[model samples]
Target: MSGGILSPLDRAIVRATQEGLPLVERPYHAVAEAVGTTPEEVMARMERLLAAGVIRRIGLVPNHYALGYGFNGMTVWDVADEDIAEAGLLVGNLDFVSHCYHRPRHLPHWPYSLFAMIHAKEKAAADALVASIAQLLGPLSRGHLVLFSSRILKKTGLRL
Candidate 1:
């Protein structure tokens, strides 16, 4: 939809921001120069795009590993369906959980309905966080597991 409706300047803005905003005081100014527009105009265009749901997110994505968070575990749980919504909100609000959401379950093989990502500086810390989450879920959880990430993958440019 955006591809067809966006002006050339807007398209350039999308390309320029595909990776991320420049790490500078006036990132929008830099973007304006790249797209041949004024900073205020760029900001206005961005606001319009966001209002139109063309841009979904604009925020800092912290580098946990760089900040001494060495262990990353994607904790998945098989929670009671009726209780998943409440449990997910609880887990998602936890200080130690970076991401928490509900996903579909593939029964007979993979049955995890709740997914939460826990990060820590060490394996023990990550494990402790997982334990806390398990305890929090208690009887509402059917089963759970941790899928540890062994390596960090660089974030490349736009997917499409």
Candidate 2:
């Protein structure tokens, strides 16, 4: 049995796939070949890593821009602290909301705590999505701001 530290092979696997899995039918096999191992071995090791919580998850990161979703809005809400959990769950389940989570509130200048990300082809569509979230939150939402993204940010998973 091994300790908590990652093995060399495990590190190799993480490094190879950290950027992203290959865009192919058999991505794991490609990763295995790159890391000098069999696909089965690579899959088994990845499973172990997931079970141990060494890696949170493995999933595709799509480019919304390429998909014609140019309007990206990060909507921040001033949700009641006690009702944040329920509010977050409700907002997060919406089809338009990509992600929703709680954040620490800064009093006075910045009172918003809950945040949800959304994307659409037009600004109006993005606003409508935000309004739906607001309607869902109801009185639990004190106020909110839909901060549209001005530029694309580098998106990457954890590094080895």
RMSD of each: 2.1, 1.3
Q: What is candidate 2's CA lDDT for residue 40?
A: 99
TM-score of each: 0.89, 0.94
Model 1, TM vs. native: 0.89
> Where does the lowest 10-residue lDDT sum fall in candidate 1?
151-160
- Count clashes in each candidate, considering only residues at least 3 apart in sequence or on different chains: 0, 0
- What is the C-alpha local distance difference test score of each model? 0.89, 0.90
Worst 10 residues of 2 by lDDT: 151-160
The C-alpha stretches of model 2 lying farther than 4 A from their native spots are: none
Which candidate number maximizes TM-score?
A: 2
Question: How much is 115 displaced in model 1, in angstroms?
Answer: 0.4
